[model samples]
Every structure is written in C-alpha cells, then in structure tokens.
Target: MNQHIQPPTSTASSRIYDILRKDLVGGRFAAGEKLAINALKEQYQVGLSPLREALNKLAAYGLLIQENQRGFRVPRLSRAELDDIAQMRLALEGMAFEQAIVHGDAAWEAELLAAEHRLKCADMTLDKDDEWERLHTQFHRTLVAPCGSVWLLRFIEQLHDQFDRYRRLGPKMPVIRQELDQQHHELVELAMQRDAQAARTLLDDHIRKSYDVALQCFLEHSG
Candidate 1:
C-alpha cells in the first residue's frame, strides 16, 4: 500500500509577511514609504493581527523600521550602510572564491559549467524574471560551493540577500547588464582555469561596481 503525502498548510501571517517583504525588497514600496497596517490588511485581505506580525517580522530583518507612536516604513538605504555591506561581502565572497578555486574538483567544475549555461540562457531577456534571478543566484552559489566552511557560506548568503534589495534597481541603470554580463563571463573563465587571484579581483570589482552605481542612483533620487 502506498502512503498518502499531505501538503503543508500555508499560514496567513507568513504569506502576508512574504508579500510585503518581496514588495519592499523589489523596490516597490520605495524607501521611507509608510506601511499602514490598516491599509495592508485591506490590501491583503487579512486581519490586523497578521499584518502586525508581518510588519514586526520585517522590522527584525531590517527591511522595515518601527517608529514609537507612529508605524512601520521601509528603511532608507544609507550610503554608509551600503559601503559597510559591500566591504563585508568582498571579504566573505573573495575568501569563498579562493577556497572553491583551490578545493573544487571535477564534479564542482561540471556543476559550475551547468549553472553558467543556465544563467546565460535565463539572462537572454531584457525583462528579467524572478526565475532568472533565482537561477543567477544559484550560479553564484555554485561557484563557491566547494568551500568547506558552512558558517562562511551562510554569512555570505545572508549578505547576498541584503544586496539583492539594491540589485532590484539594477535594470533601471543604463549599461549595467552589459557590464555585468562581461564580468560574469570573465569570472567564469578565471574560475575554470583555477586562477584564484584573477577571479578574486574580478569578483571584488564586480561587487563594488554595482554597489557604487546603486548607491549613487539612490542618493541622487533621494536627494
């Protein structure tokens, strides 16, 4: 006899939280925009309790800020914070690249090649899809998959997520895609050849360029 499997029930609070989080990170709820609970409840068709819970959860993630006596709003992206994050990302991701280069074997190389192919295919569209973003993220993750340190990879993943909020703004910037595609191709070449130093340098430059452009655009628009 075959056993029946059950799908897990989706919780309203988590669903509401995810929707708001996506909108916030996708730059839909622009920085410092007020997030009224009543409005969200009406918009999501949920009650006040779930809405409050969702907002509180997002506050913990630094995406939303709660003001005493006021309410929640999208946190403003500050240049200082962006720079600090970029510095941390450089250190972590650079180390990961080094480890992957030194330790990755044939299987890892094959996986990297497959991921690169998927990324190239998904990136063909000018209108970026969430699916393409997912595949792109997987490609980067696979590039560093040979690194043995779980803690370091976890930290790097968190930083990547934080940087993603700013990355959503990338499409609006002219020439960003062409520059990114070139950098990615170079990175893949260096990695495949086991040139750790060149890969690390390219990775660092790639991370910083996007951060610099995004920070400048954000500042100009906000100012």
Candidate 2:
C-alpha cells in the first residue's frame, strides 16, 4: 500500500491532509467514528502538529467534525442529509446543465464526450478504487463546464465530495455501480443533443437513485 502512495513533495502537513481526507472518503472509518490522534500518528507515521493540521483541514472541508475537547470524527450521515443533497444537486447541477446546453461550444462538447469515455474505460466501482472517484468527478464537472458559473461549479464539486463518502460505504457493490455506466453515457448523449428536458429528467433520476441505494445500504449496516 505504501509503495503506490506518492511521497509528499510538499509540507508534511499537506501530505497528511491529503491522505487522511482520502481515507475519510474511502470509508476507512465509519461515519461519526472517532478519530484517534494517537492511532493516526502511528498509522500515518506523522508527528502531532502535522496530524493536527491535517485534522483541522478535514474538519474545514466538513469531512470531519471537530468538537471543542473531543477532537474529530467522520461526519455523520442521515436520510435527511441525503435528501437535501439530492435536491441541491438537482437544482444547481440541473441549472448548470441547462445553461451548458445553451452556451456549450464544440470544445465543451468534446470534453464531455472525452470525460464519458474515460469513465467507461476506467473501472469505476465506487467502493474499490480511488481513481474511479476522480474520474467520476471529472465526468460530472465536464458536463457542466460550459455553464459559465464559477460559483455553481465550485458548489457542485463540494457537494460531490460530501456525496462520495456515502457511496463508498453503500452496499450496492460493484455490479450496481457498473450499471451506472449506462446512465453516464446517456447523460453525455442528451447533453450533446441539447435535450434539456430529457437530460434533466435523467440527471434527477440518476442522483436520486444513487442516494436511495446508499441510504438502504446505510440502514442495513446500521441496523
């Protein structure tokens, strides 16, 4: 595992932040699980200060919640949270897609197609490999890149980071994740055709279905 991980070329704090954030998103710890500083120090081979720096950063990202004296824990997940995120994605990303269709140039179209292709060709089992997460993010971001709203794009990316932890811990497994490839491909297709109604419908269904599956997974495991 260590062999594949790139050695930190930046500050030790930066490396710790990157690695810890990935683990949080990867479900290395369950939601709301306590983050033990002593254990983490031994796990990542880092000093106390740098570890604290990393923890503080993750808390800033909302991946971890920090308590006054309790330190940090992975952010808790809930059905209500999922619903809110789904609706926000539907509103924000839906608008981005509509705007993209209106203003999308040939370059935007090409990037969207390319993003879809990369996702298809990559193994994107959400629970398995981290590369899949990067590709998945790229594909979604590319779809809305022509929307001309920087703030919207930033919000979309932040929401995706929040959404990822749930997906990683979900029980739908690799097979169900593979099935999402079709939805992704069709989203690109509808975007290319500039069919806003069809595209938004599909996008809404896509995000909602994903949340539904993840919610079920959480319930099953939590029970």
Candidate 3:
C-alpha cells in the first residue's frame, strides 16, 4: 500500500477563508447549506480555529449566517430583499454612470476603450475561462471608475457580487448575452460622447434587465 502525502501551503485560516469565499460566490456551496465547522476542518485539513475564523469572515460578508448554537449556514435570499438589492443597484449604478460621463476625462475614455477591447476578446461561452469572467468584471468596473465616490462603488460591488452567481447560472441564455453586448456597446458609445442622460438611461435599463432575468431564474430554480 502507498501512503499519500500532501504539500505544505499557506496559513490555514487564509486558505480556508479564500476557498469558502470563492465557493460561496460561485454558488458551489448553494444557498442555505449548513456549514459544519468540524467537517470543514476535516475537508480543508485545518483546525477548528481556522475554520471558525473563515466562517466568521463569510458571515461578516452576509454570505453566511451564524446562529445561536446552530453554527453557520449560507444565507437565504428573500424576494423582497432581492427586490431591494436590485433597486439600490439601479440607483447607485445609474448615478455612477451619469457621474462618469460628467467627470471622466480623455484618459478615462482611453481606459474605457482599452477595457472594452479586452472584454470583446473575452470568451463568453458557457465553458469560457474564468479569466474572461474576471476581465469582463474589470471592464464593467472601469466604465464607472471615474465616479469618485467610494461608498457608491462599494455598494455597487456588493450588488455585483450578489447578482453574479445568478448571472453565471444563466450565461447560456442567448437573450442574456445579446442584450448585454448591445447594452455595453451603447454605454461605451454614450460615455465617449459625454452624453450623461443617454448613458444613464442605458445603464439603468441594462442593470434592470439583468435583475429581471436573474430574479426569474432564481424563482424558477427555487420553485
């Protein structure tokens, strides 16, 4: 019989934290799944302390719930809560897009163009590389990076993360990709022309459309 040896690596707490975060955001953990600390410690080859720390971090991010004597589990999404999140995203992202149009300079325009080019080269297929998803996110972030409001960006990022799991689940929808690309093109074009009103309208519509699709998918799947 041959014995297997594992490689030594980074701090258990950080490693556990990163892995859990990725899995939570990717929907691999699934919503409302119980997170048993002992099982996690065994799976990650870590101790209870590191597993607890990782769970605490996830709870802080609203991705997990730490109940009294019940341990941790994935957070549940209610329809009302989802609607609130969507509305907030629309308001914040719409404002950011408008401000970017007003405040963005030539350098911002250049960056936006470069980002768009990178996004265009991204593989949008269902089996696309994870790197493409990362770049796609960066390109969208770059579009509104000139907004100059830290709180606004923070809120938008939170909404983006919450929405991303559903987005990934429905990537194979043709209408999703077609509408997304069309909206991105229009947004970039309007921003380049510094048309604040048109850009904001497009941005609002783009965000709302995705929210609607995600909500529909979420409901269907949950049912």
Which candidate comes out best when scored by TM-score? 2
lDDT string, candidate 3, 66-98, tens digits: 985549987775677678778887888889988
lDDT of 3 at 149: 95
- Residue pairs in candidate 1 whose N, alpha carbon or C atoms collide under 3 angstroms: none
Model number with the top lDDT: 2
Give the better candidate number (1 or 2) by TM-score: 2
lDDT of 2: 0.81
lDDT string for model 1 (94-211, tens) is 9999999999999998898898888888777757777877787898899899898999898887777677777776545547766876787788899989999999999999988778
lDDT values, one for every candidate = 0.80, 0.81, 0.77
- TM-score comparison, 2 vs 3, better candidate: 2
The C-alpha stretches of model 1 lying farther than 4 A from their native spots are 1-10, 47-50, 68-70
TM-score of predicted model 1? Answer: 0.81
**lDDT at position 88, candidate 1:** 94
Ten residues in sequence with the least summed lDDT for candidate 2: 123-132
Clashes of 3: 0
TM-score of each: 0.81, 0.85, 0.84
Clash numbers, per candidate: 0, 0, 0
